[model samples]
Each structure stands twice: as structure tokens, then as C-alpha cells.
Target: MQKDLIKELCLTQDLIDIAGTGTASQSSTSKWSKENDAQRAVSGKEFKDFAFHTDMETNPWWQVEFEMPVAVEYIIINNRKRSPFDERASELSIVAYDNEDNEKLLHSGTMYFGSEDRGCPLIIPLKGNVSLKKLRITLLKEDYLHLSNISFLISDPLRSFGDKPVFIANRGDGLGERLRALLNSMVLAKEFDGHFIFSWPLSFSKSEFHAIDNPENVFGRDFIDSYLVTRDVLNRCEIKDLRNTMDFISCDNDDYKKIGINLDQNSLKNQIKDKNLQPKNLISEYKLAFEKINFNEGVTEAINLAKSVQLKDKVLGIHLRTGDIVYSDYRYMDRYYNKVVPFYTVESLITRYLEMGYDIVLFSLDSSACRYFKDKYGVVISNDLIPEEYDDIQRAFFDIVLMSRCTEIVGGLSGFAILSSWIGGSKISTYKKILSEEEIKSSFTHSLSENGVLSSGFISPLLKSFSIAHYLQSFKDFSSIIERIELLKKCIEIDNGNNYYRLLLALDYYKEKNFSAADGILLEAVNSTDKSNIKWLAKTKFPKITILSIYTLELEKYASQGSIVAAYVAFLSRYYYDEIDMNIAFYKDFIQKQHNNKNSIDTEFLKEIQEKVNLKAENL
Candidate 1:
């Protein structure tokens, strides 16, 4: 009944690749060569190894008859060519047949492949209960059909849960912290009969603020097979770089409070429903997941260290972490903000537990905090628990084991503390700092301007530029329209090549009715708008938007690719000239259609623009 007891490996979920055993065939009347045979599709080799290719013929199709009927939830397809998007594969049709030849249309839709989906699975979820004996996929056009690989994820026990996929997306976080996401996902996978994928941080030493390695190196196989990286027995991230941009439903690692200007709050709410997902059953899940891993010499040594500590049954755990030093520059403070709960704040928990007579274990990254805890109540120091040299991962796992053994824990607002409590079956109280709306706006690591809008590490540089432009537009408290125009000019000065910022400046100028000023920037925005950047940069095709009545022909060509903000602004400009008018029904229909294509910045912009548009339309 001990919460922290290390038990044997528990295999709750089993994921296997059954595509290789199946028989594959293409159209018999086809004049394609033998080298481009259909068997290659079911070869089950890593992506880019080989593919089943077909000539540019009408309605090219490939079929595979499974060795046996199996219950499947997702079918992952990989295109031979990632970049320049295999447009032939864009509009695809899939059909499946049971043993009785009863057909079920598995999937029929258009899929967008961005740069993130490169060398990764284009996951397609099946609708309902599907037991397939044979499957066929068609290009649905007169185009060359080249497929690198096909995979089916079948879990009979977890059939009812369907396609609720989970992804362990830990970027630059520590082992113990990432494990919290991994373990929670494993628990959820079993609880809901689901499957999960992960991208492990490189085993290389952690750099100050930068990632340990570039994305290319970190996602490489060397890091995946590294001794330090924990591997899933059933489903490790074999198809690495698990980017969920294209995926509609998935759980990625994200701190709820850390969300910024461009994040989708509604989508985040759906992903992390904290009420149902607390680690009440984590201790058992941890024991089962790592039970098989104990045989590793390093793991055994860590376990022995945990046993050697031999702390009293009623042991108290105190977890603390210092993400960044309070440096003079304060650039690194964002990582630490809201994570640390002051010692004085949790002093009551420590004192109350001490009166109840429990042993104490202080596990911390902050040496000074450890000293304080040890000095105050004479707690067991896990930092000094390791006798001599320690592997970075082993040392962290040692901390994990020790913390899990505690009867209760007083810790900060981090996954490390929350997950440790789950593992030890210990009562944990996390002291989180509360921030006002204004404080939250300026909290993260950012370069704040005189107008007080912040831009920094919270968003990718590409998106940060877009989000900053959006914040500048929505800064209600500070700047006048003329003042806002000056800020956009300065922003454009700093990032001269940004078409997004240029287009935003045009929007502002138009609003001021400065047609000449708007027209000047409109020329710059048009000339700078590069479809190549859209096609190749992120392969996102996310068009830069503008509301100028004299919008360029090139801009009109890709206007559909722009966010709803573009649609509204353009429509309003037309409406002002009596060129077009919209009702509530038309506006709602537009939102419904353009909702999925929107990026985070679009979400933020849409919220502000939507409110203004809705209020104005109420009068109409």
C-alpha cells in the first residue's frame, strides 16, 4: 500500500505495426514498372526508405488487404515528397472493406501539409468502429500517386475511446518535468484507450537560455536511442518531430497560465480539462511504467539509493526549482515567474506537517532553499543523497524516486511538484502567485517599448512579429491613432522585411482615412508579399492581410488564405463604398468556415475585431 514503492513494469497499452504483414497490390492494367510495385507501401520501413509510385494516370489507386481484420482508430500516411507539397495527395479518398465486403468510406477530405508535417505522420482519424480486411486509397485526380509509407494504429481494448491522440511535446524542459507529461499521457492513454507520441529533449547539456541543440539534431535518431532518453515500450516517437499543427485533436504540454496574445483559449480548454486529469492514479501508473526499467544498471543504482535513504513511512517532501536567476537584465525571469512560491507562503504547511510527526525530504534545484529547509527542520537532503558521481538523468530520477516516497509535499506551481505528488500518493499543496490582467500582459520575457507592448520568447520569432503587430493594434489604454501609427513605423524600421507588419500599418493608415499614407504602405506591402515565403518558408500559405480598396491583383489571388480579420476588413471597406453588405447570418457563416484556418494571432485579432463588428452590426 506504500505510495512510493517501486513495482514491476505495467503494460497497460500495446501499440504494434501490422501493415508489413499485409499483401499490397495496385491496378493490374497499369503500365507502371515493377520497381514502383505496391508491396513497397506495406514494407513498413522508415519514411523515405521506399515508396509505391505510379505514373501520372487518371484515378491512380493502391490497395492493401490486411492479413487479418483488426480494429483500427488512425491511419497515418506519409508522402514521398514533403516539400513542394505532393498536391496529388492533397485531395485524397480512402475506402475500407470488412470480411463480408461491406464497404466503409474511411476518409475523404483535403489535407494541408505544412513544414511541420514534413518527415512526420499525416495522422487521419477513422470515424467510428472499423474492422478492416482490405483498404484502398486513391489520389482522386489525374496525378502521380507516390506514397512513402502507410501505418495503422489498432487497439482493441481502447477501441471505444477512438481518436483522442496525445503528444508529449516537451521543448527544452528537464527530464523530471517532461516525465510528468509523459506519465500523465500514458495514464490517459490507458484510461481512455488512446495512443501517444513524444519528442524527447536532446541528451546534450542544457544551455543557459537556448535549446540544447537545434530541432534537426534534437529530433534525430541519436537522441531518440540515447541512454538518457526514456523509451516507450509500446509507442516511442519512431515517427519523430510529432508536430500537431495539422492535427485537430491532441494534448500537447502547455502551462495554462503561460498563454499569451495569440493562443487559442477555447482549444486549450478542450485539451487540458484539469478536473478529470489530475494524477490521482499516477503512483500506480509510474510503478507500472518504470517497473521494467529498473533492470537498467543506472536505474537499479537510483532505486538502491532510494532504498538506502530508508526514510520513515510518513515522510514529507519539499520540491523547489529555480528556472532562472533574478539577473539584472531580467530577460530570463519569464521562465521563473509564477513557478516559484515563496518559502514564507508554505511555512504553515511545513509547520503543520512537522506537528503531525512526519519525516522530511527536501528535493530542490535551489541550493539555498535546500539549506534553509535542512536548517529549519533537519529534512533529508536528496541533493546529497547520491553518494558520488551521477548521470544527469539518473540524478533526476533519483530525485523523482525520493520525492514519490514522501507522505506529503510542499512545492511550487510546476509539473515537477504535481507529478511527484501523483507518484508518491502524497498530499501536495502548490502556492501559485496571482497576477492582475496588466501584470500578466507584461510578465513574460519580453522587450517592452515605451507604449508597453511586449515581444519576446513566449512566441516563435515568426509569430512574435505577427502577435506584436496585433498587440499594437489593440493597445486601448495607451496610444492615440497617430501615436500607434508612429509605433508601427518604428516596428517596420526594426524588421524592415516583414510584410505582415507592413500590411498591419496599411490597416491603421486606412482607419485614419489617410488614403495617401495608406496607399504608400499598401505598395510596400504588395511588393513585399512573397508567395515563395508562403510556399516554402513555413509552407503555411498564411497570406498577409490588408483593407486598402486598391489592393493588388496578387493579393486578391490569395485572399482566401488570409485570416477572418482580412475578410472582415475587406468586407467592411466594400460595405462603406456600398460595394457589399453583410447580415448576421452571413457573418456567422463566414466565421464557421474560416475558424479552423485561423492561426493564434488570428484568434486574438478575431476576438477584438469580432466584438467591434458585432456591436456595430447590432445597429444594422
Candidate 2:
């Protein structure tokens, strides 16, 4: 039977297990039993014992003999259970016998087990080689051991395999909303599979490591097959290097093969091409899209009504955007505006235009700002017909359509405002000055331009200073204004109503403020019927106030050009209280002269002026 069994084992190429029998109480039926006095016992010369266990006291001992003397470097003991043993294994020992048949112990140590011992079995190294034909068994506890099956696996020495690869997709949390959009493009590129692993920087505890010993916890049942105590490997160089290496590949390099990935470059290029192939890429597309959408019929009717009643030779479309510096912070809580319009910058820009003698048919996004402008600067706004809840994009589209009908545009440095100027086939003007690199790097809070306009590209001082100065000067030049307006009109007409001509117009207007008859002409160019919340002075009240203050001061010199004592006095009275000390005496003397000649001014107007002057003097 033994010979047949050996032949069967040889034929199957499987390891053979020797079972022992004992009495019922101290039964040899346990599969692993120390030899009885009656049973033949092999006196060991030199041998090693490898034990397999299911639990603490349930380990089964095994003895094996080789055909020839072979050196055993390591033993791989497989635990087939789904769970690991609760207690630690006692000992792994190598015993040798001298020529006198005396057993001598060589080496012994406790064997350690991992969290999931069943998944990763223990590998114990042997100290030395021993010559023996047979080995003896000593059964310890049997808590987790199954007496029915026992076997041993032996293998030669090999290098250890490194840890599993960990993949991370690192992106700023502020970009979370746009991540889906960006990922949409990425997914189409076929560079990455849908499966992704998220590794949060924070979310682990040391106590969680002990829970890994449980089969359900370690295996994660159906959820995950593998998990690591991340904190344990937190500072590990291998982990950091792997994460950094992957980040370089996925983000920085943008090269596929360098990071061991295969992708079709042609397909990716085609996808990018498709994005650029949007219908709105053409001028005809803009016209079609605009025409297809039936805009405010009421606004269009109002424009038609205004045109039929009285026509201005020129219509200037004004768009103002108030930006809050605090909103630039990436946190969600502070991203939105506290008010509808940013008043300070808008007011400043508007004041500049008013000084140039521009009749602004302002289209403001801030309703409150529009009222304020009308009350303060007497600027007529045309956006009251539009809805309040329209989002920035929708407002932009509406502004484009409205601006397309305008002769000139005055815009603030905002995406919405700029888009309006771009859409308005008109001469456009902006209030901001380009900064030099040195200027940008300075510590002043007001020096920084919005939306990265300063550092966008290399800009020459001549081009910048001249552009701003020219736009300011243009506001006072009729011929220059006409030329710029005509140039913008031509660009828009030739470019299928493209806004680039308008941007150029704005650039020129921004360079030189020529507030001439073209202001009325520019005002005539817009569709007054299109009402939007943007037309409200409340949207631009603060900026309107600020810009008006600046323009009023700048045009203070021009008020005397008329030499009407009453008009000059009126201008001085309106601006004197706000002017700095440098011009305070000039305004004060002009006011005194007007007051002395009471015949030139109406008695009521003079009394009101005197009252204001007295109030100012009292405050001082």
C-alpha cells in the first residue's frame, strides 16, 4: 500500500502526507502524534520541523525525509483558512544528533504572523543543513489546526518582492467643480481608465491597524481586496517617490510612454480638434445663435420706439463689472459677491468718460449702481428691461447681442464686461493701465490688475502709457473719436460683427479720451430696447461715483473754456468739496468771484451754493 501510494504520489507529482494513529483518549488518529514506545521511532541525527497551524493550540507537526541530502534555505507554510490564528506560533526548531546518538538543539525561535496570515503565509529561514532519513513529530495545541490534512512546501532563496503600487490623482480642491468638465476631456483622450483610487491626505488611525486582522475587515468582503495602514507608510520614501513619480507622469510630463502607458496620439489630437470645431467658432455661427434666440421682445420694442421717437447720431454701450478682491480666495464660502456690482472701479471709469463729454447710454449689471449714476452723473442707462436672475454667461450673451447694436463700448476689466465689449461691435475703452513687471512685483495692493491681465504677456511701456494717455485724450477729440468709431464699425462689419474691432476701439478710447459728438453717435448705435439688470446705476454706482469724481476734476479745466461765470461756478461748487488742497484755492477763488457777482447766477441757486459753502466751512 505504501509503495502504491508512493507510486500514485509520484505519478500525480504531489507531496505525500504520513498519518499516525493513536488510542481514543490519546488517539493516534489525530494525524500528527509522537511515536509510542511500540511504534518504530527514528533517532534523529540532524533535522528540522515545520508546523502548520489553524489556531494557537491547534498546530499539527510534520516530519519529512529527502532522497538525497538537500539544503533547505526557507520553508513556506500555507494556512488555507479564511482567517488568521489569534495567538502567536510557539517555535521553529532545528535539531541534530551526534555520532553517539545524542540529540542536540541547533536553532529555535518564535515565528511571527501578519494581519492576514491565511493570505500571506509565514516564511521561516533555516540555520543549517542536516543529514537525516526520517523526522519525529511533537503535537502542541489544536485550536485552529485541522488534523485531517498536513503538508509542507519548500523553496530556494529569492529576493523579496516590493510593495504594491499605489496610484493617486492629485488636483487642488478649489478646482473640484471644474474637475468633472476637465475629466470629461481626459476621459475622451483614452489616457486613463474609468477606475481611480482616491488617497485622502488625512483619514487614518493607528488603532485601525489592529482591525486588519479580522478576515472581513482585511478582505473588505466585496468592497476591496487590499488595504494598507497608510500612516505606517506615511513617511516611507518608497511611498512618496511612487506618488511623486505618478504625479509627474499624469500632470507635469503629459507624455504617455515615459510612464509606461500606451495611448494613441492621433486619437487624442482628434479629440482636441473636435473641441475647437464648435459651431460658435465662426462669425456666421454667432449671428445664427443670436438670431435663433428671441431676445427680450419688450426691449427690442423699446429700442424701436426710441428710434422712432428720437434718434441719436451715436450710441455708446457701457458695461461695468465690480470685482471683489476677497472673492479671489479659493474657499467656497467667500467666492461670491456681497453686492450686485463693484461700485468703486465702475464709478472711476464712468467719471473719466463723463469728463470727456461722453453721453453714456450705460448698460449696467447692477441695478442699484444705475440709479446712483443717474442721480449723481445724470448718465442714462438702457438695461432696465432685462431680468435680474440671469447668470453671468447668459448676461454675457445678452450683452453681446445688445453691444452688437452699439457704436462704442466702455468696459471694466471683468470677463462679463469684456465679453460685452467684445460682442458690442463698437469702440471699446477700459480704465485699467498695464503694469510693468517691476510694478506688478511691487507690494502695493492697488497695483495688481484683475484676471492676470498684467502678467499675461510682455508689454512695452510706450505702448501701455501711450495707449492709456491716448484713450484719455481721445475722449476730448471729435475727429479722433470719429476715426476710432468708424474703424471699430468697419471691423465689426467686415468681421461678421466680431467684437475685435470693438476691443480695438476700446483700446484706442482707453488710450485717448475723446468725448466728442461721437458720444451721441455711439449712444445711437445701441438698441435701447434691450433692458437688463446691468443697466442699473446701482450695479456701477460706486465705480460711477469714483470715475465721475476723477473725470469732473480732470474736466474742471474745460468748464472754464465756456467762460460762463455761472457754469464755471456750478462746476467748481460741484467738485470743490471733493478736490484735494492742490486745487482747493483755485476752486475757492472761482466760487468767491461767482458769489460776489450775484447778478450772473439765479438768487435761489446762489443761496443754495452759499448754504453748501457755509456747511463746508462749519465742518472745517
TM-score of 2: 0.23
lDDT of 1: 0.51
Note the Cα lDDT for every prediction shown: 0.51, 0.34
Q: On residues 309-368, what C-alpha lDDT tens digit does candidate 1 reach at each position?
A: 777768877775543322111211122334444333334445556788987776655445
Identify the candidate with maximal lDDT: 1
Model 2 lDDT, full chain set: 0.34
In order of appearance, the predictions have TM-scores of 0.36, 0.23
Best by TM-score: 1
Candidate 1 stretches greater than 4 Å from native: 1-172, 188-197, 208-283, 292-295, 323-335, 344-349, 432-620
